[model samples]
Target: MASSSGLLPSEPRTLPSTGFQVVDASETIEEETLPGYHLGKYYPVRLGEIFDKRYRVVGKLGYGTTSTVWLAHDSVESRYVALKLYVANLNNTRELKAYECLDEADEKDHPGKTLIRKLLGSFQVDSHSSNGSSSHLCLVHEPLGPSLKEILDLMPPYSFHLGFLRPVLRNILIAVDFLHARAGIIHSDLQIANFICDVRSSDKAMFAKFENAEFTQPTPRKIISEEHIIYTSRRMSLSKALPLLCDFGETRLFSEAGTPGEDIMPNVYKAPEVIMHMEWDYKVDVWNVAMVVWHSLTGRPLFNGRSADGKIQDDRIHMAEMVALMGPPPLRFLERSTRMTRALWNEDGNWKNVAPIPDITLEKLGADINGYDKEGFFLFFRRMLRWLPEDRPTCEELVYDPWLMRELGLGLGR
Candidate 1:
């Protein structure tokens, strides 16, 4: 399939119809590890490429900030899988180790694989057209559907009901709990994009149909951007499907109570402690899951830092928004925090930069969880959205929440 220049083949190459524009797979593309790689750029993978002589890339699935996921046919398992190829020296060793911890836990009592995406295997692949270039770290995972935000995009304005919202959101919290308690890892980047629709097929023909399913391919959907994408529609019952929590590049050990993380999470979903540089632990995950729940209910971001002019604002704006929705940080919280104190308050406990956060009650959040599901939703919501991390309910406690049980009717914790 060589073209006249002998680089790209003249034969037409198939591209994903996922809507995001991509370079022709046949174009002369440089690997990210190449000498002249640019920011916000990655090597465009071509179809029919083989990884470690086992998985052959056939279609494009999606793209993340640091990697690109391809639909590959697994010769070993005789099934379709996803190959997440990362940039060279991307510091993914820690993430792999975290997965190992999860695997070890799964081998014992907890079934972490059922909650998060299954890590099939990992291997390395040589770069394209780079003479003697280093191999890229490729993570092999089970195939999953579009992300939660993607499904939300497909819904009409506020079309998602509490019935769908409850189950899906609870499942995400369950996955987060797995990472925090069993795995002992902090999913520093917990957001809607990191959650994918959980679905799989074993039938060869059926799997093939799934491999070629027409859906919006996610590109340009930057993980940390202020905007949310609209998916328009989905081919399956997204609510009935589970959510697979993926991406662990920012993961870390769930430190002891007083130990702090240097940096973690995107600005919008970031916890006050994390943003303010205070001691944080698994509670950051708790804060993020609350934001995820709100987004699920409203199909709008719970907090955004961008200005009305579409310009990205500073982190102070995010803090302002949190204060607006959740009310001000507790005085004890203010006392313990240095960065936030200097940013928002003076020594006399007087407000400086922060505005008085107005009232945005739970009932106004959506349809109010409705007649049968109000208690469960509100109780869980109140417990999880606390200003103090210590005040927030642990994942274990949230599991038995009346709201999740009664509202979701999930029989999750019985």
Candidate 2:
């Protein structure tokens, strides 16, 4: 069951084949369509070859930076499953080390590895490149919904229902807590864009009811379509209680040893301590959770900057915007910043590492200003976006927040 936020059905967009594609043009097209230039129309391994020949690849479901997901049917199990194949580039020592570490930890610490993307199974498959020296390795998982970012983009003035919001936030928080508090990992890339709705059988029932609205008894075809739609809409609710902290491509193990710096993450959700290269920890994940919750409540990202180029200037622009909304970093915090930020501090006591917030102001333009009705949503935003990392709430505090408690109806954990 695949749960999607905002997908409108349309004819698949076809690309014109160029005899010799230029690097620049190919780069642009690849970025917009596929993450890489190699989008195989048909690959070497289909459903029949893997999982002891029980699964059959039906069609492509989704794509990502390092993998392509295909919807598959398990013949023996009589069910649909998702097959995620890792890109060949990830077969190197760096990624291999991380994968080995995660696999070992999952068996020992997590056992089921329930919160993050479950590694259904992994196997090596033959490659079909011009130079087929190496084979591809793929992992299997249940299908997930369109990312929160994609969902928001498709919706008009993007918004999530309270029914959806409360549970989703709960799930995200718990997942983060597990990653930081339990697994000793930090999901460096924590954002609405990374959250996927995990839909399953219950959606079929909801769709049945919805389809039956038009007729005393709806046709099988109509019911099936409705079921698919409902499945897409509500698969991975926070109520499901699944740990779905995904995009571990940026994840890092932060023991007493130390943590990686801002260089590892996208500029938007990065913590100030990371920007300043200070001793950071789980609180950074908390900051990211706050940003995700804010996006969930309001359909807009709290710290979106104009620098899509992912440059240091863009980071600066993002930081300045954050400072404007949340206030300047504390003097003590600033005193500890690296020379980069020290040289960047502005007259307003805000770090000059960032420029003035761009003309694209969320409040002034009402771009990211929706869904403010829930109590303390703004307060949550204010707290999370504190210029000083120490000023931010811990994951434990956020889990027990009044706003979260009231909205989630977890007064006594009944």
Candidate 3:
């Protein structure tokens, strides 16, 4: 039956009896084996299921611990949007508040604002199941393509070209600047996975093809019970690539200063202040941006925090690597959190030898690029990778760094 909007067919699309494969129940499907996954947790979304009487679910995009994202057609607007449906009873008010903070900023002319993925709308959905009735919060956003890491993985060498990397890093810096300066927010998590390619005009065609494929081929899915069905995620095809910083689940808001003593950021990208349990602010993001840029240029992580067995994360090992690369933390820097500092360092600002420092330097590691480019690259890294968070350059300053501008073939004037 045609919906009242007359833009989508609200009835569920019938799948072919023989064409599509039925996944075995015993095998782990998309989110079936997730730690907290159970009946009534994730909304049992089906193809062609309409939400809010407007968005028609077309295909599964991806899933995370807190939510499952789907590609949906907005019948009211006649555009494709990504519906991020959170797990039942998940507290996502922080993420919503971060978006609101960005929205409140008066920076329409800010270049970084465009490089950030925008929240179009949001609503709540009620799901009734054998377990109980639960409400899930759903956020609507413009559908985007694969992440920078995913795109890099698809191509051989799995690293971005210097030419392409320049603009991508610049865009990221701009986005970070907007978050720090204009929006009064801190994106505590900044990594390659959080940087995604924007959907272009050419990429919009992929959505129609995805919908058509769902109608004819139907995604292979595991049917566990009446309340649960797990569908394989479908990747969106993207021809034109533009970087957009996304994922605000770990974002924190700071007005005029810093937020202290809160553990944030992924292990590999943690700032020195974060490790020492001291006050941290926008500079932590600066450190994160440096690590991300370094990782993008080289396939390997700049700092590997894993234990020798690679079974668990060891902060001592991570600090050892940091000292070896960036030199030992200064006495004053260590004094910020005396208790935590004493555990890792001596009175003279020397490492306590819980883990041996790796015999590596930035100069030795970044040996690929030659001469001027190498010098400039390391200079840029020096500006951000400091032992003290306050020593790191602001995102605004990094955006106009000589090395980045020269690589992008832009003058300081621009």
Candidate 4:
């Protein structure tokens, strides 16, 4: 029984009590007064409001610097969907174009397709307030559960067991492979936050329960003024635990190879080629996968890229760490970036003492792994962590690596 204006049935003439708690204006709520936050920039979304004449807002999911995400019920499809509303006047053409590329790709039969989050639809909404009118871009997507980072936070050890980590890694590699080989897209930003868990079964029931709770026990909020209200975000329960690669805002379309000198990726996960300002390609993503594996298994970052005080990131320190762990860059490799080579190394290709290289090795860092599988694990890392991008294995090759598939009973007798 969908209403003409929305999916849910019409509300009663006399609305029921919301039972919402109001907070003082001075109290901080979700995304209130954060950097870049301004009135008329973000669309003032109200609970129970229907957008695009169909999807009804259930509750706030979360907010980022550029956008706010909400859980909504799609009346036409009779299912729950997530709505990402970008700040007014923000340029989101890159992300939209990436989705368009994915939609046009002829890889429907690819197994990795299911591991990537699907974009449902998109539209523009005009907001009118006392200040002015602004148009916001809204993207509709399939609802998902918590991110891998959030899940890790709940774990006491903040790390995943090998059994749990294996499948997640395999699925991520498959998804990356699909993006590279089929879509010709490179997801430049790959991190724990972008790896979200999928909500597969019992989705309807779960969303319905969430909507009902919003009606009976509304989320607390702080009303700043007549036009601004900050509501606390509601967290969804864990789902089937399948990892989906998300966030295409930084994705680049590659026809043959990547464009050099383009700054991408978080500082900590940056590849050597990226650090040296040299040509990079899909292998940069291979380097990212290695860092992710190290973080997930060790519960700590392998590279912090920090200065002496650790208050800011310094490339010299970061490069020095790589030297300590992987040894000096080959002269052939140094020739790729003459400027960086001159700054960090002597003419004879020896360390110029720009920064003190730490005394460390991969074996010492990963010594905590059990004796039986330690060798295999480091071997897998060596295949991807090479200073030369060409030396690193591709996502497809790493998917079949002996270490990742050893306990899963895959890649046997190879």
Question: Native-vs-model 3 lDDT?
Answer: 0.82
Could you estimate the TM-score for every candidate?
Answer: 0.78, 0.69, 0.91, 0.90
Residue 327, model 3: lDDT of 85
Q: How big is the positional error of residue 244 in model 2, measured in Å on the Cα after superposition?
A: 3.2
Stretches of model 2 off by over 4 angstroms after superposition: 1-52, 75-78, 92-115, 161-163, 204-243, 256-262, 307-313, 346-354, 357-375, 408-414
lDDT of 2: 0.54
lDDT of 3 by residue, 1-414 (tens): 232212344444655545667898788877777877676788888776899998888899888878999998887777778999999888888789989998888787788889999999999999887878889999998888888877877876777766678778889999999998898998989999899888666456667677777767778888877656788988777547787999898888886335556778888888888877888777889999988988887766789988999988888999999999988778889889889888988888878899999899997887663334666678888898898777888998988888888855685432
lDDT of 2 by residue, 1-414 (tens): 222311211221222222222233223322125534443322333322344465555444455566666555455554555676666645533334345555656344432245556545556665555434445666656555556776666667577665467657766776676665556776667887677755545542332232222233211110112111101111222223333656666666775423535475666666777767776766777778866766765776667665656543455676677666656667777666556566668545665444665544334533444443433555555666666666777665676766668665665332
Give the per-residue lDDT of model 4 (tens digit) for 1-414: 432212343331222345688988667666665876667778889876799998888888888878889998776777678999998988778789888888887786678878899899999999888879999999999888888887888776787776677789999999999888888888888888889898756443565556666767788887766767777888777767687998887888886446567789888999988988888887788888888888887777788779889898999899999888888888888999999889989989998888899988888887664334666778888888788988888899888888878766774532
Q: What is the C-alpha lDDT of each candidate?
A: 0.65, 0.54, 0.82, 0.80
Task: Identify the superior model by lDDT, candidate 1 or candidate 4.
Answer: 4
RMSD of candidates 1 onward, in order: 8.4, 9.6, 3.5, 3.4
Candidate that beats the other on TM-score, 1 or 3, i.e. the better one? 3
Clash tally for model 4: 0
Tens-place lDDT per residue, model 1, 1-414, is 211111222222364545654444343332332454543245435555667886766566665557777777766556667789886557578779878888776435544457788788898766544233445788988767778877877867643566766667667777778887777888878888888877633222333543344333433222211221211111333434667888887887865333554667876787878777778878888888887777767777677766657577556666776776667677888877776688787877656765544356666665533335555566677787777899998776787677667654555443
When 2 and 3 are scored with lDDT, the better candidate is 3
Q: Which 10 consecutive residues of model 4 have the lowest summed lDDT? A: 4-13
Highest lDDT scorer: 3
